[model samples]
Target: MSVQSESVTDTGPEQTVGYTLHGNRYLNITNRCTLRCAFCPRFNDEWTVQEYPLRLRRDPSFEEIVLAVGNPEEYQEIVFCGLGEPTLRLYTLLEVATRLRPHARRIRINTDGLANFVYGRDVTPDMEGLIDALSISLNAQNAEIYNRHCRPKLPGSYEAMLDFVKVAREFVPDITLTAIDGLSGVNIPACKKIAQELGVKFRRRVLDVVG
Candidate 1:
Protein backbone atom coordinates (compact mmCIF):
# COMPACT_ATOMS: atom_id res chain seq x y z
CA MET A 1 0.00 0.00 0.00
CA SER A 2 1.12 3.56 -0.73
CA VAL A 3 1.84 5.98 2.07
CA GLN A 4 -0.98 8.49 2.60
CA SER A 5 0.95 11.66 3.23
CA GLU A 6 -0.21 15.28 2.99
CA SER A 7 0.22 17.00 -0.37
CA VAL A 8 2.59 19.95 -0.57
CA THR A 9 1.68 22.51 -3.18
CA ASP A 10 4.33 24.20 -5.31
CA THR A 11 4.15 27.88 -4.45
CA GLY A 12 6.80 29.28 -6.75
CA PRO A 13 8.38 28.88 -10.18
CA GLU A 14 11.98 28.72 -8.96
CA GLN A 15 11.71 25.35 -7.21
CA THR A 16 14.11 22.88 -8.86
CA VAL A 17 12.09 19.76 -9.61
CA GLY A 18 14.70 18.17 -11.82
CA TYR A 19 18.46 18.19 -12.32
CA THR A 20 20.88 16.53 -14.73
CA LEU A 21 24.09 14.74 -13.81
CA HIS A 22 26.29 12.29 -15.68
CA GLY A 23 23.83 11.87 -18.55
CA ASN A 24 21.06 11.15 -16.10
CA ARG A 25 18.01 13.24 -15.33
CA TYR A 26 17.27 13.26 -11.61
CA LEU A 27 13.99 14.01 -9.87
CA ASN A 28 13.56 15.81 -6.59
CA ILE A 29 10.14 14.80 -5.34
CA THR A 30 10.32 15.15 -1.56
CA ASN A 31 12.73 16.10 1.22
CA ARG A 32 11.54 13.60 3.82
CA CYS A 33 13.83 10.78 4.93
CA THR A 34 13.94 7.78 7.29
CA LEU A 35 17.59 8.28 8.23
CA ARG A 36 19.77 11.20 9.31
CA CYS A 37 23.25 10.18 8.27
CA ALA A 38 25.95 12.26 9.89
CA PHE A 39 27.68 12.65 6.54
CA CYS A 40 24.57 13.60 4.54
CA PRO A 41 24.74 17.09 3.08
CA ARG A 42 21.36 18.20 4.38
CA PHE A 43 22.22 17.15 7.89
CA ASN A 44 25.42 19.16 7.71
CA ASP A 45 23.44 22.33 6.82
CA GLU A 46 24.34 22.03 3.16
CA TRP A 47 21.44 21.99 0.67
CA THR A 48 23.30 21.82 -2.60
CA VAL A 49 24.23 18.68 -4.53
CA GLN A 50 26.81 19.40 -7.24
CA GLU A 51 25.81 23.11 -6.95
CA TYR A 52 22.11 22.43 -7.56
CA PRO A 53 20.02 23.51 -4.57
CA LEU A 54 17.89 20.57 -3.29
CA ARG A 55 16.13 22.12 -0.34
CA LEU A 56 12.49 21.60 -1.14
CA ARG A 57 10.19 24.21 0.35
CA ARG A 58 7.38 21.90 -0.67
CA ASP A 59 7.23 18.51 -2.31
CA PRO A 60 6.09 18.41 -5.92
CA SER A 61 2.95 16.57 -7.06
CA PHE A 62 2.90 13.77 -9.63
CA GLU A 63 1.95 16.18 -12.41
CA GLU A 64 4.71 18.59 -11.44
CA ILE A 65 7.31 15.82 -11.34
CA VAL A 66 6.25 14.56 -14.76
CA LEU A 67 6.47 18.07 -16.15
CA ALA A 68 10.02 18.37 -14.78
CA VAL A 69 11.17 15.57 -17.05
CA GLY A 70 10.60 17.50 -20.25
CA ASN A 71 12.21 14.86 -22.49
CA PRO A 72 12.88 11.55 -20.82
CA GLU A 73 14.80 10.22 -23.77
CA GLU A 74 17.34 13.02 -23.55
CA TYR A 75 19.15 11.38 -20.64
CA GLN A 76 20.75 7.99 -20.23
CA GLU A 77 18.64 7.20 -17.18
CA ILE A 78 15.84 8.80 -15.20
CA VAL A 79 16.85 8.75 -11.54
CA PHE A 80 14.75 9.41 -8.48
CA CYS A 81 17.28 11.21 -6.31
CA GLY A 82 17.72 14.27 -4.16
CA LEU A 83 18.94 14.94 -0.64
CA GLY A 84 16.19 12.68 0.72
CA GLU A 85 15.15 9.08 0.50
CA PRO A 86 13.03 8.58 -2.63
CA THR A 87 11.05 5.75 -1.10
CA LEU A 88 9.48 8.09 1.44
CA ARG A 89 7.51 9.42 -1.51
CA LEU A 90 7.01 6.01 -3.07
CA TYR A 91 3.61 6.78 -4.56
CA THR A 92 4.83 9.83 -6.47
CA LEU A 93 8.03 8.04 -7.52
CA LEU A 94 6.11 5.07 -8.91
CA GLU A 95 3.58 7.28 -10.68
CA VAL A 96 6.29 9.35 -12.35
CA ALA A 97 8.37 6.27 -13.25
CA THR A 98 5.34 4.54 -14.70
CA ARG A 99 4.59 7.58 -16.81
CA LEU A 100 8.18 7.80 -18.11
CA ARG A 101 8.76 4.06 -18.65
CA PRO A 102 8.01 4.06 -22.35
CA HIS A 103 10.30 6.95 -23.20
CA ALA A 104 13.19 6.38 -20.80
CA ARG A 105 16.07 4.06 -21.54
CA ARG A 106 16.25 3.19 -17.85
CA ILE A 107 14.71 4.19 -14.54
CA ARG A 108 16.60 4.12 -11.25
CA ILE A 109 16.22 5.10 -7.61
CA ASN A 110 18.85 6.06 -5.01
CA THR A 111 17.51 5.09 -1.60
CA ASP A 112 18.28 4.10 1.98
CA GLY A 113 16.61 0.66 1.59
CA LEU A 114 14.04 1.31 4.31
CA ALA A 115 10.79 1.42 2.34
CA ASN A 116 9.46 -1.78 3.81
CA PHE A 117 10.17 -0.61 7.34
CA VAL A 118 8.63 2.78 6.62
CA TYR A 119 5.51 1.48 4.83
CA GLY A 120 5.25 -1.64 7.01
CA ARG A 121 4.80 -3.88 3.98
CA ASP A 122 6.64 -5.46 1.09
CA VAL A 123 6.67 -2.51 -1.30
CA THR A 124 9.31 -4.01 -3.63
CA PRO A 125 6.59 -5.79 -5.66
CA ASP A 126 5.25 -2.39 -6.61
CA MET A 127 8.59 -1.54 -8.22
CA GLU A 128 8.40 -4.37 -10.73
CA GLY A 129 8.63 -3.30 -14.38
CA LEU A 130 8.82 0.35 -13.34
CA ILE A 131 12.29 0.63 -11.80
CA ASP A 132 15.32 -0.75 -13.62
CA ALA A 133 17.97 -0.23 -10.96
CA LEU A 134 18.24 0.37 -7.23
CA SER A 135 21.30 1.92 -5.52
CA ILE A 136 20.76 1.32 -1.81
CA SER A 137 22.85 2.92 0.94
CA LEU A 138 24.39 0.14 2.99
CA ASN A 139 26.63 2.72 4.82
CA ALA A 140 28.35 0.41 7.29
CA GLN A 141 29.63 -3.09 7.91
CA ASN A 142 27.48 -3.86 10.94
CA ALA A 143 24.36 -2.67 12.75
CA GLU A 144 26.30 -0.80 15.44
CA ILE A 145 28.31 1.19 12.91
CA TYR A 146 25.20 1.62 10.74
CA ASN A 147 23.24 3.01 13.65
CA ARG A 148 26.09 5.31 14.58
CA HIS A 149 26.37 6.93 11.19
CA CYS A 150 22.89 6.55 9.68
CA ARG A 151 21.06 7.37 12.91
CA PRO A 152 17.94 5.74 11.57
CA LYS A 153 14.66 7.06 12.92
CA LEU A 154 13.07 3.64 13.25
CA PRO A 155 14.04 0.62 15.30
CA GLY A 156 15.64 -2.39 13.64
CA SER A 157 16.38 -0.29 10.56
CA TYR A 158 19.70 -2.02 9.88
CA GLU A 159 18.11 -5.46 9.86
CA ALA A 160 15.08 -4.17 7.98
CA MET A 161 17.31 -2.71 5.26
CA LEU A 162 19.09 -6.04 4.80
CA ASP A 163 15.71 -7.74 4.66
CA PHE A 164 14.61 -5.25 2.02
CA VAL A 165 17.63 -6.15 -0.13
CA LYS A 166 16.84 -9.87 0.16
CA VAL A 167 13.21 -9.35 -0.85
CA ALA A 168 13.86 -6.56 -3.38
CA ARG A 169 16.12 -8.75 -5.54
CA GLU A 170 13.09 -10.90 -6.38
CA PHE A 171 11.40 -7.87 -7.98
CA VAL A 172 14.00 -5.35 -9.11
CA PRO A 173 16.74 -6.73 -11.37
CA ASP A 174 19.72 -4.43 -10.69
CA ILE A 175 20.18 -3.97 -6.97
CA THR A 176 23.48 -2.66 -5.56
CA LEU A 177 24.40 -2.13 -1.93
CA THR A 178 26.54 0.98 -1.34
CA ALA A 179 28.65 2.18 1.56
CA ILE A 180 30.61 5.41 2.01
CA ASP A 181 34.36 4.75 2.16
CA GLY A 182 35.79 7.62 4.23
CA LEU A 183 33.42 7.77 7.15
CA SER A 184 34.96 6.83 10.49
CA GLY A 185 34.40 3.21 11.47
CA VAL A 186 33.13 2.32 8.00
CA ASN A 187 34.92 -0.77 6.72
CA ILE A 188 34.59 -0.91 2.92
CA PRO A 189 35.79 -4.46 2.43
CA ALA A 190 33.51 -5.80 5.12
CA CYS A 191 30.55 -3.94 3.65
CA LYS A 192 31.25 -5.35 0.19
CA LYS A 193 31.59 -8.80 1.69
CA ILE A 194 28.15 -8.47 3.23
CA ALA A 195 26.68 -7.57 -0.15
CA GLN A 196 28.50 -10.53 -1.70
CA GLU A 197 27.09 -12.80 0.99
CA LEU A 198 23.63 -11.35 0.29
CA GLY A 199 23.98 -12.18 -3.41
CA VAL A 200 24.04 -8.57 -4.64
CA LYS A 201 26.55 -6.08 -5.99
CA PHE A 202 28.27 -3.44 -3.86
CA ARG A 203 29.69 0.05 -4.40
CA ARG A 204 32.06 2.26 -2.41
CA ARG A 205 30.81 5.85 -2.31
CA VAL A 206 32.87 8.90 -1.57
CA LEU A 207 31.84 11.30 1.14
CA ASP A 208 29.81 14.34 -0.05
CA VAL A 209 29.65 13.08 -3.63
CA VAL A 210 26.22 13.02 -5.25
CA GLY A 211 25.58 10.30 -7.86
Candidate 2:
Protein backbone atom coordinates (compact mmCIF):
# COMPACT_ATOMS: atom_id res chain seq x y z
CA MET A 1 0.00 0.00 0.00
CA SER A 2 1.38 3.43 -0.95
CA VAL A 3 0.66 7.10 -1.55
CA GLN A 4 2.74 10.06 -2.66
CA SER A 5 4.65 12.74 -0.77
CA GLU A 6 3.01 12.44 2.63
CA SER A 7 4.82 13.90 5.65
CA VAL A 8 4.47 12.87 9.26
CA THR A 9 5.10 14.67 12.57
CA ASP A 10 4.82 13.70 16.21
CA THR A 11 1.48 14.56 17.79
CA GLY A 12 2.63 13.67 21.34
CA PRO A 13 1.37 10.58 23.20
CA GLU A 14 -0.97 9.54 20.44
CA GLN A 15 2.01 8.67 18.24
CA THR A 16 1.43 8.55 14.47
CA VAL A 17 -2.32 7.97 14.66
CA GLY A 18 -3.59 10.32 11.95
CA TYR A 19 -2.62 10.62 8.30
CA THR A 20 -3.45 12.65 5.20
CA LEU A 21 -3.46 11.76 1.51
CA HIS A 22 -5.37 12.62 -1.66
CA GLY A 23 -6.71 15.82 -0.07
CA ASN A 24 -8.34 14.01 2.84
CA ARG A 25 -7.42 13.52 6.49
CA TYR A 26 -7.73 10.06 8.07
CA LEU A 27 -7.76 8.65 11.58
CA ASN A 28 -6.22 5.43 12.82
CA ILE A 29 -8.72 4.82 15.57
CA THR A 30 -8.83 1.05 16.05
CA ASN A 31 -7.31 -2.24 14.94
CA ARG A 32 -10.51 -4.21 15.19
CA CYS A 33 -12.10 -5.42 11.96
CA THR A 34 -14.87 -7.89 11.10
CA LEU A 35 -13.72 -9.00 7.64
CA ARG A 36 -10.27 -10.24 6.72
CA CYS A 37 -10.26 -9.59 2.99
CA ALA A 38 -7.80 -11.58 0.96
CA PHE A 39 -6.35 -8.34 -0.40
CA CYS A 40 -6.53 -6.04 2.61
CA PRO A 41 -3.55 -3.73 2.99
CA ARG A 42 -3.49 -4.04 6.77
CA PHE A 43 -2.31 -7.62 6.39
CA ASN A 44 0.85 -6.52 4.59
CA ASP A 45 4.07 -6.73 6.54
CA GLU A 46 4.82 -3.06 5.79
CA TRP A 47 1.33 -1.71 5.39
CA THR A 48 1.15 2.09 5.05
CA VAL A 49 -0.83 4.54 3.00
CA GLN A 50 0.82 7.89 3.70
CA GLU A 51 4.24 6.33 4.19
CA TYR A 52 3.64 6.47 7.95
CA PRO A 53 3.13 3.34 10.03
CA LEU A 54 -0.49 3.34 11.26
CA ARG A 55 -0.40 0.63 13.91
CA LEU A 56 -1.39 2.32 17.16
CA ARG A 57 0.10 1.60 20.59
CA ARG A 58 -3.40 1.95 22.00
CA ASP A 59 -6.61 3.69 21.00
CA PRO A 60 -6.28 7.40 21.76
CA SER A 61 -8.73 9.51 23.75
CA PHE A 62 -11.09 12.05 22.14
CA GLU A 63 -8.83 14.94 23.09
CA GLU A 64 -5.84 13.16 21.62
CA ILE A 65 -7.65 12.78 18.29
CA VAL A 66 -8.56 16.46 18.45
CA LEU A 67 -4.90 17.33 19.00
CA ALA A 68 -3.91 15.19 16.02
CA VAL A 69 -6.53 16.69 13.75
CA GLY A 70 -5.77 20.29 14.69
CA ASN A 71 -7.88 22.28 12.21
CA PRO A 72 -10.14 19.91 10.27
CA GLU A 73 -11.01 22.66 7.82
CA GLU A 74 -7.57 22.29 6.28
CA TYR A 75 -8.48 19.12 4.44
CA GLN A 76 -11.06 18.49 1.72
CA GLU A 77 -12.68 15.78 3.85
CA ILE A 78 -12.15 14.28 7.25
CA VAL A 79 -12.20 10.51 6.78
CA PHE A 80 -12.44 7.74 9.32
CA CYS A 81 -10.23 5.26 7.45
CA GLY A 82 -7.40 3.47 9.09
CA LEU A 83 -5.68 0.09 8.95
CA GLY A 84 -8.77 -1.42 10.54
CA GLU A 85 -12.52 -0.93 10.33
CA PRO A 86 -13.25 2.58 11.63
CA THR A 87 -16.72 1.71 12.95
CA LEU A 88 -15.18 -0.74 15.40
CA ARG A 89 -14.97 2.37 17.58
CA LEU A 90 -18.28 3.78 16.35
CA TYR A 91 -19.07 6.06 19.33
CA THR A 92 -15.57 7.50 19.37
CA LEU A 93 -15.67 8.12 15.64
CA LEU A 94 -19.04 9.85 15.96
CA GLU A 95 -17.92 11.95 18.94
CA VAL A 96 -14.76 13.07 17.17
CA ALA A 97 -16.70 13.76 13.98
CA THR A 98 -19.16 15.85 15.97
CA ARG A 99 -16.41 17.94 17.54
CA LEU A 100 -14.83 18.50 14.15
CA ARG A 101 -18.15 19.06 12.39
CA PRO A 102 -17.93 22.82 12.65
CA HIS A 103 -14.49 22.89 11.07
CA ALA A 104 -14.92 20.03 8.63
CA ARG A 105 -16.58 20.72 5.35
CA ARG A 106 -17.27 17.05 4.73
CA ILE A 107 -16.85 13.94 6.82
CA ARG A 108 -16.65 10.41 5.38
CA ILE A 109 -16.11 6.88 6.53
CA ASN A 110 -14.42 4.21 4.38
CA THR A 111 -15.67 0.95 5.81
CA ASP A 112 -16.32 -2.70 5.14
CA GLY A 113 -20.05 -2.13 5.76
CA LEU A 114 -20.38 -4.36 8.82
CA ALA A 115 -21.18 -1.85 11.57
CA ASN A 116 -24.68 -3.24 12.05
CA PHE A 117 -23.30 -6.71 12.52
CA VAL A 118 -20.69 -5.38 14.91
CA TYR A 119 -23.23 -3.58 17.09
CA GLY A 120 -26.24 -5.86 16.52
CA ARG A 121 -28.26 -2.80 15.43
CA ASP A 122 -28.60 -0.27 12.68
CA VAL A 123 -26.25 2.65 13.37
CA THR A 124 -27.12 4.60 10.22
CA PRO A 125 -29.66 6.85 11.92
CA ASP A 126 -27.02 8.01 14.39
CA MET A 127 -24.69 8.97 11.54
CA GLU A 128 -27.28 10.91 9.56
CA GLY A 129 -25.95 14.46 9.75
CA LEU A 130 -22.57 13.69 11.22
CA ILE A 131 -21.22 11.79 8.22
CA ASP A 132 -21.32 13.59 4.92
CA ALA A 133 -20.59 10.47 2.90
CA LEU A 134 -19.79 6.80 3.12
CA SER A 135 -17.43 4.72 0.95
CA ILE A 136 -18.52 1.16 1.57
CA SER A 137 -16.42 -1.65 0.18
CA LEU A 138 -19.06 -3.89 -1.30
CA ASN A 139 -16.38 -6.21 -2.53
CA ALA A 140 -18.68 -8.79 -4.01
CA GLN A 141 -22.16 -9.08 -5.48
CA ASN A 142 -23.68 -11.77 -3.25
CA ALA A 143 -23.30 -13.36 0.13
CA GLU A 144 -21.54 -16.41 -1.26
CA ILE A 145 -19.02 -14.37 -3.25
CA TYR A 146 -18.57 -11.96 -0.34
CA ASN A 147 -17.84 -14.75 2.07
CA ARG A 148 -15.39 -16.31 -0.35
CA HIS A 149 -13.47 -13.10 -1.03
CA CYS A 150 -13.65 -11.31 2.30
CA ARG A 151 -13.51 -13.88 5.06
CA PRO A 152 -15.64 -12.32 7.74
CA LYS A 153 -15.13 -12.89 11.45
CA LEU A 154 -18.88 -13.01 11.90
CA PRO A 155 -20.62 -15.70 9.87
CA GLY A 156 -23.56 -13.62 8.67
CA SER A 157 -21.56 -10.45 7.97
CA TYR A 158 -22.25 -10.43 4.23
CA GLU A 159 -25.99 -10.15 4.73
CA ALA A 160 -25.47 -7.72 7.57
CA MET A 161 -23.24 -5.52 5.41
CA LEU A 162 -25.78 -5.45 2.62
CA ASP A 163 -28.49 -4.59 5.11
CA PHE A 164 -26.37 -1.81 6.56
CA VAL A 165 -25.98 -0.23 3.12
CA LYS A 166 -29.67 -0.55 2.42
CA VAL A 167 -30.56 1.32 5.61
CA ALA A 168 -27.76 3.89 5.35
CA ARG A 169 -29.03 5.08 1.97
CA GLU A 170 -32.13 6.36 3.75
CA PHE A 171 -30.11 8.37 6.31
CA VAL A 172 -26.84 9.33 4.59
CA PRO A 173 -27.16 11.80 1.75
CA ASP A 174 -24.12 10.56 -0.10
CA ILE A 175 -23.33 6.88 -0.31
CA THR A 176 -20.85 5.14 -2.61
CA LEU A 177 -20.43 1.41 -2.87
CA THR A 178 -16.97 0.37 -4.01
CA ALA A 179 -15.37 -2.73 -5.45
CA ILE A 180 -11.65 -3.34 -5.60
CA ASP A 181 -9.68 -3.53 -8.83
CA GLY A 182 -6.72 -5.82 -9.69
CA LEU A 183 -8.24 -8.83 -7.99
CA SER A 184 -8.81 -11.63 -10.44
CA GLY A 185 -12.29 -13.07 -11.10
CA VAL A 186 -14.19 -10.20 -9.44
CA ASN A 187 -17.20 -9.10 -11.51
CA ILE A 188 -17.06 -5.33 -11.21
CA PRO A 189 -20.16 -4.89 -13.34
CA ALA A 190 -22.17 -7.11 -11.04
CA CYS A 191 -21.03 -5.11 -8.05
CA LYS A 192 -22.02 -1.89 -9.82
CA LYS A 193 -25.46 -3.30 -10.56
CA ILE A 194 -25.82 -4.18 -6.91
CA ALA A 195 -24.95 -0.61 -5.91
CA GLN A 196 -27.43 0.69 -8.46
CA GLU A 197 -30.13 -1.57 -7.07
CA LEU A 198 -29.18 -0.30 -3.62
CA GLY A 199 -29.54 3.31 -4.90
CA VAL A 200 -25.99 4.42 -4.20
CA LYS A 201 -23.12 5.69 -6.31
CA PHE A 202 -20.38 3.29 -7.33
CA ARG A 203 -16.58 3.42 -7.44
CA ARG A 204 -13.62 1.12 -7.88
CA ARG A 205 -10.11 1.24 -6.38
CA VAL A 206 -6.91 -0.66 -6.90
CA LEU A 207 -6.44 -2.97 -3.98
CA ASP A 208 -2.98 -1.60 -3.21
CA VAL A 209 -4.03 2.08 -3.09
CA VAL A 210 -4.72 2.14 0.63
CA GLY A 211 -4.96 5.87 1.14
Question: How high is the CA lDDT of each candidate model?
Answer: 0.86, 0.81
Lowest summed lDDT across 10 adjacent residues in model 2 is found at 1-10
Best by TM-score: 1
Question: Which sections of candidate 2 miss by over 4 Å?
Answer: 1-14
Judged by whole-model lDDT over C-alpha atoms, candidate 1 comes out at 0.86
Error at 103, model 2, angstroms: 1.4
| TM-scores vs. true structure, each candidate | 0.93, 0.91
Off by over 4 Å in 1: 1-14
- Report clashes for each candidate as comma-separated counts: 0, 0
Per-residue lDDT tens digits for candidate 2, residues 1-211, read 3533343434554356677777777777776688887777666665655466777777777877777677888899888876789898899999999999888999999999989888888899999889999999888877787888798989988788889999998888999999886666678999999899888999987766754
Give lDDT tens digits, candidate 1, residues 1-211: 1211111212364367787777777888888899998888888888877766678888888988888787899889888987788899998899899889999999999999999999999999999999999999999999999999999999899999999999999999999999998889999999999999999999998877777
Scanning candidate 1 in windows of ten residues, the lowest lDDT window is 1-10
